[model samples]
Target chain A: MTRLEIDHLYVPVAGRTILHDIGFTAEGGSLIGLVGPNGAGKSTLAKTIAGLLQPASGTIAVNGVALDTMDRRDAARKIAYLSQGDTVHWPLAVRATVTLGRAPHSGRFGTASPGDRRAVEAALHRADVLSLADRNIQQLSGGERARVLLARALAVEAPILIADEPVGALDPRHALNIIGLLREEAARGALVIAVLHDLALASRFCDRLLVMRDGRLAADGPPHDVLSPAGMEQHYAVAAHHGTHEAERFVIPWRTLNAADRKPNQEGETA
Target chain B: MNRLPAPATSRIGTAPLCLILLGILAGLMLASLTIGYVHIPPGRLVQAAFGMADPATTTIVQQLRMPRMILAALVGASLGGAGAVLQGLLHNPLAEPGTLGITGAASLGAVVALYFGLAATVPMSLPLCAMSGAAIATVILLVVARDSASTLTLILVGTGIGGIAIALTSLAMNLSPNPWAVSEIAMWLLGSVKDRTFSEVWLALPFVIVGLAALLAAAPSLDLLSLGEDTARSMGLNASRLRTMAIAGTSLAVGAGVAVSGSVGFVGLMMPHLVRPLVGQVPSRTVLPSIIGGGALVLASDIVVRLIAIGPELQLGVLTSLLGTPFFLYLVLHLRRQLP
Candidate 1:
């Protein structure tokens, strides 16, 4: 189990602040959906947490250990990251791609151990890619390729898994399948964080939603609380029809809202 | 890469295939020693090789043929292995060893050494100067080109460096003291393995060995780099360290190669691509076979040059270009649909 804490993180790229004073704590065994509008710094925060970017200020700690103090290989063993769609540069075999996740666990010159092979096998099985293991990554469908990358990350068996838009181009069914896989990872005691664009999927699957707007954490709470019409209007500038049926709450964005017309008969409540 | 059975299984267990290539390399090396203007019989060749034959045969085999053959093989191996490293490091199929200006820099150093009569005055000065030039080129390349730029940007920067170095070399030749030195520079620029000595072989072997070792050690990193830079870093690969090893290895290997042989072209660039079908596209798997294939290509080209030339021997570099350009174009045309 891992505790991932990003405290007062500020990230700058090219002299412009991209993530400002953003903070989040993700305990093990929960699926976190990071949501945001376009250019809202979600990917920047994901990359920073994955150690692909260095923050300008504040710290990221994994299980009470400062990320800055840990050796890169050690950190890799603790946190596995999968970038967005088509991150694979080589046309590697699915099995070969997944096996690369064992890099940090292998011996000198990446001589694999039995444990590593077992991990790859388990990852393939868990990601439902065992049958595609022998296929070329480039030849696979987009959704299948995404699953292979997921298996690659799963092969790491890290306590924390961070994926930046893993399902961005996936169809709805594939997206739901992927979200369910992340939920499974969380159930298995991994701190799973995925940046998602589909609000309905996020509300349906994620245990918590961390919403970002213009470099700030606009909302952080259960989906029901974060997807309220007022919360959505303030951050997203959209009006949505929200309803609860039995045990489920769903948000359907109906129209764009202007600032002046946003308040309703609550014009009287303002007094 | 070895943990699972790769989908590209033709090269899965490649020991036997590499052994066959090594065997072919050995055969070609022997043929290079035996087949020339004066053909030595197999029995006499063995005697000449072991220094038991008459003085003339012994001199022809031990002194003349031996150094040239060894140097050709070494040069070929260095270039091929270096090309493989470069392609892996940059994730570009067009990434040749000379694409980063190491060979051009080496050529500049050698030309300067020749113009100053340093090569004639000091036996070690030529290789030393060439290696220094290569090192400088690598330093400049790293400082300028290895900064997360797009692949095309890196290639363009390298081409600019090569252009400047080449222009300077031509300028130096234009100002030569006499026509003889000018012609000599011109012929040397065409690249050959003629009249090389055992001492030059000894001078270059260490750098090639060191470069090969460094690249082999960094094989795992190259594999991860093939996964793309972001995932490679998240996998705990040190990008700076990977780039350093790659650049250092290419510098030593190609610099030493250019030092011994003037500037043999295309063998390094062509061998890896040719051997990929046999070994799959994995960079690590391509190293040994490409090295062996490179040595064979050099020996075969040298043989053809010797067999066809009636007066002056054809330049090894010229033969390679004639042989390689069409093959390279064919490969690109064939792989046009598949290339990234």
Candidate 2:
């Protein structure tokens, strides 16, 4: 099975520590959700894993190979990263854009092999963007653009997928559809780590959750256990409404807990 | 709802487009050879190529026009390829060697060479000095914007350098001792490929070849970069390495061209945009066509300069600017909507 290990990763942005002592181990066949409030270092941690940002200290590895030491092409072959709010600078065709996902395997001049074309075709079909293949990316609707970009990442066919806010700004139906795709990717034996803002989707669909608070991994466990009432109140400083629907558990943030609402012992607990 | 608009595909395929561009370049190059003041017919030109023509015809074709024509092709290819690479790297359609100050710095270097009377006395000093100026500007821009993490910083620094170079050139013009010196400087700034010899051709050829090769190698990486830096890096692109290669290549190719010919503008800026409709918007794919298209445009412009023969010859750079400015203004006016 494909495995990702981030050990005591300390990432700094502009010389200020953003992700401190963050560590996690993720394996294939599970959907892991990374959820946190604004500036909680979740995206920072994700970027570090994607190799966009180097860690200030500590290591990130896949299987037994150190990510820092591995050939970038080899690393790219193993880990596919989908950035938040991705924009295409040029008005490229959707098929051509998705075909860029095969950059690592296509070599220097990008002559697509038969196997590469098959992978791109499969990714286009999987993300439901096959019909829009000939359309320009600049003409795509926001939801359609999101799926096309997802198709680009899926074309990598990597063993691990790291997506930051994959469903950001999407409507409910599209968001649920994207989340379902991630779950399906996990079922197909790819390790999928997605940063999500929606607690309901995170708790209901993820096999595990990694909660971030003040640049630390505050909690890590199955979503149900990690989103306990006390855990939610402690890390998120909010009262969560919990319920079971169709035999699936869900947690929705019902109200913000201000300094005045915190118990004496919990007062000044936020860093 | 009405059906969404689709992207326009090339009615002509890439291979066909490239072949057409090549044919145009060949036809233009041939026209460049024969259409000078002393017109040699195509049959005589063929004999001249093999040294079988009369000495006068052979001397005119082999000695004079050949170097000038080669220079035009080299300068044009440099500007065109450099422009496409800069546009792709900066993710801005407007980026070019002229905009990034490399061409301006090269102009300043040539001016300095002329100011000191170094160009008249020394055989290769003019181009060498101009190339040095371009190299220095490139190094300063790269070093100050070391990260390549922020393209904005690189562009801002480049603009500042370009402004400084133009100011220095103006200062040189203002302080000239005589009207003759001033006119000489002004004429050089207007840019031309007249009366150049094989020496100039030999000087620029290597740098242009190396520089264009570097840019062509960068095409695939540039394609990946159009998706944004973060995504490009995630796909194993060594972005800093790519940036260094691109800027250095621009300096060498464009710097050497500026050294040999003066500042030929708009060819670099316009060719890639013109080639885009035929090649689609992929940055890498736009490169080769831009190179060939650039060569064709310059050769055609040079031929026009020769054919005009009005009073004195029209400036090559002046003709390009006359053509390029309208296209540039159109781009600015329609900046809101992304065009193919």
Candidate 3:
């Protein structure tokens, strides 16, 4: 298990800063959800923390080791990142694709070990892609392909798993299933950070929620605290309806907030 | 007893297949040496190889056929390995030197070297110029193909660059000083393994070996790269670094090949397809087999060149093109369904 620590992390693309002084600490054994609108820098924060994008002005540490100082393979052994996209370059078999997740653990020759095969099988079962292991990835449907990719990440078995919008555009059932799988992964003592747009799913599965607005962590707390009516109105620009079902909290976005609902500044009330 | 558990990804039994291909390649090389119109028997050929035969037979087997066969093997293996590397490195199956116009650059470079009267003065300068051309074109390709260039963009850019280089080579051929030189240029441009001397092989082997080594070193990284650049990066790979290594390796292999053979087409593009089904699509495992399969294909083509002899005989490049065009079309048609 590993703990991910980010202090005043900044990511700048071109000249403008995309992530500004973002700070967060995610310990192992939790499914943490980062929720925000488009362009809210959730992906940036995740990529930066995963070492895909180098943080411009702050430090990210994996297992108390500074990420910048770590080797690429070492950093990879600690963190597994699944970026949200449609990507399967070759028509590789599903099992072969999942085996790529063991790249960091394997030697430079990519020779497979007994442990690597075991991890791949376990990941295939956990992601529910074992049935499709022999099939070509290109032949699988979008949902199945996504599951295979998820299986690939799970095969990494890294202590810290950061997935950027893993369930975006997935059907409700598959989306819920993916989140549930992440929850299970957290139970295995992996620090699973998933970026999600669905507030209800985020509220349902995430042990803690990190809300982002304009490159900043607008709010961070339990789903109940971060998905509150005012919290949704302030950071998400949506008015949410809070509900309880089966001893768990679920938040629903009723409507987009109009100008009338915008909180007035203390200095001046133009409206 | 030594055994591994079930494979982590690939199917079993690729080793025997690789050995079979190696056996085929060896048999073909001997057949290439023995089955020529010269008609040296296998026993005499072996005797000649070991310095136990008459001087005349030794000269025919050793001095003449041996170097040409070795050169063909080197060129073929280089194309095969380089082709596999390019496909995995760029994650584009259609990425091969002949298709991507690197061959045109190499041809243009060799022609330019010859046109400057440098080949007559310095034999090594020809391949050096070719290497320079390949390296320059690769640099241009990298600059033109930003990391995010789409497949269409890569194809279109490759076509555009290739067209310009071919046209320039034609222009150089037209402005030649004599008809004899023009004819030589035309025959060379058609791409043949005929009349290949040992000296040319010596000139190219070092660079081609280096190129093969570069591609082999990057094989493992390419397996990870097959899963998109972002995912590859997340696995602690620097995509740009891998990109540089792959291109450099290509320049070395294809540059030396085009330097000697004058732009033999499609061996690099075609070898991986032949080897993939047997070895699975894992980049690292496929590389050596691709090299072996490439050597087999080119060696067979050289034999065919000798078999169908009228007077001047068919060039090796012409045969590869004749066979490769249909394969290219088949792949493109399949690619049409696969691409969005």
Candidate 4:
């Protein structure tokens, strides 16, 4: 079954269209990378899917249910979203913050059940922050905080996990660890969709890639096909060099030019 | 199998802490009843409590001192709970009732009510007016701040509004027609629990109860909010709705408190900060402790106020200001040091 479906999604903010005719589908247990530059509306699309922002038009569906029709709590149970930046006021313990993911399942009085506690502990373990469970979140380093946030989302145990630049602020090792964790989640039958800026990471870690340009999907396919030199030149106006390193493919943007040089770039004259 | 580690109780749980606080509150209640200028014996106070004392002593204890003590506890608790909620919502430890201007607005309302002779005609009318004023001011502040507004903007705007409200209150007090109106307004502004009767306590209780319940209900939401707005919303909690509810609930509780006790400061601002670290910064746990601590602080200050008076009683506000100003300065410096 398709775990998430976006059909003709249009999003506008402040009278400016940020996303137009954007659509995609991620089947269950798939790791999909959403790749684009700064103005590609990647975060906006993620927010719309999470129901945090209303689309200007079109529809988003999760498990064949229209997102607009479902209650926020029900949507929350099915999908968990982790944004690019988070601000925490109080210096809460890591365990305390992660336990907040079970808020939807908990009653109005917010008493965590046995199941909730187990989920929190499991998430902390999965994110490898169990040793720091009692430490204050604010006292942790940036990478540690990012892992803690991932643990918080993991505690939700939702089938669809949407993370926008989840590893943007982390070191290379921590970033790779987070990508590995997301892959593990996908292997466990969760749809893991991450909006990422690192083309090399996307090419290596993701099973499929969706390239966006100017608020529209430019290409969608396996990484080898979608990240070709020709596609990169045509859509991104940049030349990409792809090579295999340590049994993994890496894509790097090497140069940029106008449409006049597109033909030569596509013909591999630059190489 | 290894025995499951005993449920961590290094920090006291909510229920036991509540019981202990209730016990302390009960003791304070009895102490408030026993200690006075007339020095009613503890036995006599207990007898009066049980309705076994002479009518005169009974009147002095039940009708005079008992009501004032109850009002003090209620008002103190309300201020403390409101402060915790506000601080959590604003995500700034410096955010407090005084900073937000809810108390100033309430005092202005009370002064207006007094000037119009409405307080004399109806005892509850003044508190009602004060509550409405508080609600209006809070709504305006929230509307202006909106969802995306920064904490700095919220505090700056709140401080500006608070200053304006205080100015208006001073103006109203100065312009009163009755010769006693100025003194009455001055006394109300300064804050005191002296010479109060049961009638005033009854007038304020319902509002306090309703407001406190609302604040308690918002406790869990406040905890989620401390994680910040976007996180809260992504967790299926509506941040705007929670913020509105918190502000409204706080205004109602603090407004009633101000209308009755006349702008008692510091309790609302200081209680939450004093208890948050102790309770691990969880809003759910901070609520009761702040209440207990606030009550204790205010009651202790009130006792001191009574003890130090020579001819006429000094206002509780005066005592609180004298105690609180230094703490406020320390907080300002501490917050500056902690800033990035």
Which has the greatest DockQ? 2
Q: After superposition, how far is residue A188 of candidate 2 from its true place, in Å?
A: 0.6
lDDT of 1 at A82: 89
Once superposed on the true structure, which residue ranges of model 2 sit more than 4 Å away at CA? A264-271, B1-8, B49-52, B117-123, B136-159, B338-340
Deviation in angstroms for B313 in model 2?
1.3
Residue B251 lDDT, candidate 2, scale 0-100:
78
The alpha-carbon lDDT assigned to residue B192 of candidate 2 equals 88
Candidate DockQ scores, in order: 0.45, 0.56, 0.47, 0.43
User: In candidate 4, what are the lDDT values of residues A35-110, reduced to their tens digit?
Assistant: 8767788888888788888888999888789988987788888888887875666778789889988886787775
Model 1 chain B lDDT-worst window of ten:
B1-10
Per residue, candidate 1 scores C-alpha lDDT tens digits across A89-162 of 45567888898899888865656788999999999999999998877677788899889999999998899999
Docking class of 1: acceptable
What clash pairs does model 3 have? none
- Lowest lDDT sum, 10 consecutive residues, model 2 chain B, at B1-10
Mark the 10 consecutive residues where model 4 chain B has the least summed lDDT. Answer: B1-10
Please provide, for model 2 over A9-50, each residue's C-alpha lDDT reduced to its tens digit, 9 standing for 90 to 100. Answer: 999999998888988899999999999878898898888898
Give the per-residue lDDT of model 2 (tens digit) for B51-77.
Answer: 899999998888889998999999999
What digit string (tens of lDDT, one per residue) describes model 3 on residues B1-340? 0011222245545688679889999999999889776799899999998878999888877777887798888888888888888777767777788888888888889899898889889988888888778878777776766655567678778788889988998898789889888888778888876778788888999999998888888777888877877788888787787877888888888889888888678998898877665555666677888888888999999999889868978899999999998988888887886676
Model 4 stretches with alpha carbons more than 4 Å out: A14-17, A255-271, B1-10, B144-149
| Chain A superposition TM-score, candidate 2 | 0.97
| Sequence-dependent TM-score of model 2 | 0.94
Report the lDDT tens digits of candidate 4 across residue range B1-340: 0011221123566667667777877777777887778789888888887779999898898888888898888888888888888887767776777777777888888878888889999878899888887887788777866654565677677777788888988788777777687887888889988888878888888888888888877777888776666667778897777776777788778888888899888787788877665566676677767777678777777777778858888898888878777876787776775544
